[model samples]
Target: MSFINKMLPNVSLIWPDVWQATLETLYMTIVSAIIAGILGLALGVWLVVTDQNGITPHPVTYNILDKLVNIFRSIPFVILLTVIYPLTKAIVGTSIGNTAALVPLVVGTIPFYARQVQTALVQVDPGVIEAAQAMGASNVDIIFRVYLREGLPDLIRVSVLTLISLIGLTAMAGAVGAGGLGNLAVSIGYQRYQSDVTIVAMLIILVMVFLVQGIGDWLTRRTTHV
Candidate 1:
């Protein structure tokens, strides 16, 4: 008790903020990740499948989706926070809180992760697909049972990267009044010159990053059956 009390500044005031901020951060990261992961994976598979040499090539569809993905991925995230405020407001009823912050977070990461998924799927050995085809595997079987399974480890890696990047974006989102550790550190700590508050928030963010990284690595290892 004494040691912890000495380490933390104004324990009564700062403690609750730390816990709430941490929850807000995790809430946004996890929910956005779940939504992004599902959509990104589907969009990615579509990209790979619609290529000229793909199993179900449709050049027009591919070209359109490809362009859309490129456009969203090109937008700088901070600018995106405001550029899409009207859409965010429509979706969440307000564009300035943690819940609303998820709008841009999910949108930004979906394309980013979609491209990562595309690259991972593209790297799967061509010979493996040929083998599946030779065995009369349907397109759905090839996609779900083979490509996705073979790409699991890489998918896990990119998922972690996406989450970490999203964490940073959440901090940026804080600039718009979206509350989290970033908001706490910026609005209260840095603005007030409370270095201790800043330090604690930074430490908490670092620990969370490390924890996410550690879990991702473990999952990747487990998925790599060899």
Candidate 2:
């Protein structure tokens, strides 16, 4: 407290609120990421495997999914938040709290991350896939044991980008009463003109962002043998 107060004299009054807000931010990110990761991975793999020249090659399904991904990707997240308010409320019983915010956050991230995942899967070597096929591997087996396994390093990189992106969006969602560090920063800090609080919140967010990036980079390096 002494050190923090020395650096930012008002830290004493808001430290407790800052800590609570940090937890809310963590809660929002973790829950949102988990939901997005699962749904995005499935949609992404399906998009890749069902394309005209892909492993399963169903042109119709691929085209439909491709269009949907494109459409969702086009909608800016701030607009999407309000646009989906009814459904978000129905699902989460509110449209402005952290949990309600998850609906839009997850929906907003899914298509983007799906595209990232698809791109990563598409980077798998053609020869490796051909060899897998030559060994009579089924499409499911190829998807799991080949594309996902071989492209993991790239996938990790994309996941890091998505997670960082979500952190920013969470800050924006704070405007709608989605309580988090973002809410603390914008509502209490900025709106209330407490520059010190805003600075502290931003610094905390920066540290979190750096940690996520460093871990992702480390994991990518560890997973890559070449």
Candidate 3:
């Protein structure tokens, strides 16, 4: 105990705050990731299914969704926080807390996850899809049993990637007003010259990222038969 304190001299002072911040960060990341994942999956599937080469080609629909995804994905997250401030405030009734941070987090992640989903789905063998169709499979059946099933491994990989990215964004959210490790590190740690605090916060984040990655790899391997 004494030796640990000697190393992170200031951590004990704000240990409670650090713990709270960790919870807040997890809350924002998990909630937002879930919402974004569902929405992004829908959008992604739409993109694949409505494309020129899709099961139901609709060039107009594909172009519009494609452009929207590109536009949102290209925006810097920091700028996105500001750009969507009004929407955040309107929806959550405030724009400076962990809950409020969820709006932008979901918005920012959706397009990115959507693109990842699209990529994974596209990698599903076209020949396999054709076979399913020839076997009198409905579009819905092909989507569920073939596209999603075969692409499960890649989807899991991309989901891990998105989750890790969302965790980083939660840190950035802390810089502005979201109460998380990022806020603790930047607002109290860095600004107050508490180097130990900054290090602790960063270490926690790294652990979180690694855990997500490890779990993702295990799931991918388990699902991947071929």
Q: Top lDDT: which candidate number?
A: 3
Q: What are the TM-scores, per candidate, against the unseen true structure?
A: 0.95, 0.97, 0.99
Which residues of candidate 1, in runs, are more than 4 Å off? 10-12
Tens-place lDDT per residue, model 3, 39-118, is: 99999999999988789999999999999999999999999999999999999999999999999999999999999999
Candidates in descending lDDT order:
3, 2, 1
Which should have the higher TM-score, number 1 or number 3? 3
Instruction: Name the 10 consecutive residues with the lowest summed lDDT in model 3.
Output: 5-14
Model 2 ranges with Cα > 4 A deviation? 1-3
Q: Can you give the lDDT of residue 30 in candidate 3?
A: 90
lDDT of each: 0.88, 0.91, 0.96
lDDT of 2 by residue, 1-226 (tens): 5797777876577778889988988889999999999999999999999977689899899999999999999999889998999999899888878889999999999999999999999989979999999999998899999999999999999999999999988888876699998898888788888889898989989998999999999999999968
Model 3 has how many clashing residue pairs?
0
TM-score of 1: 0.95
- Candidate 2 accuracy as lDDT: 0.91
- Worst 10-residue lDDT window for candidate 2 reads 6-15
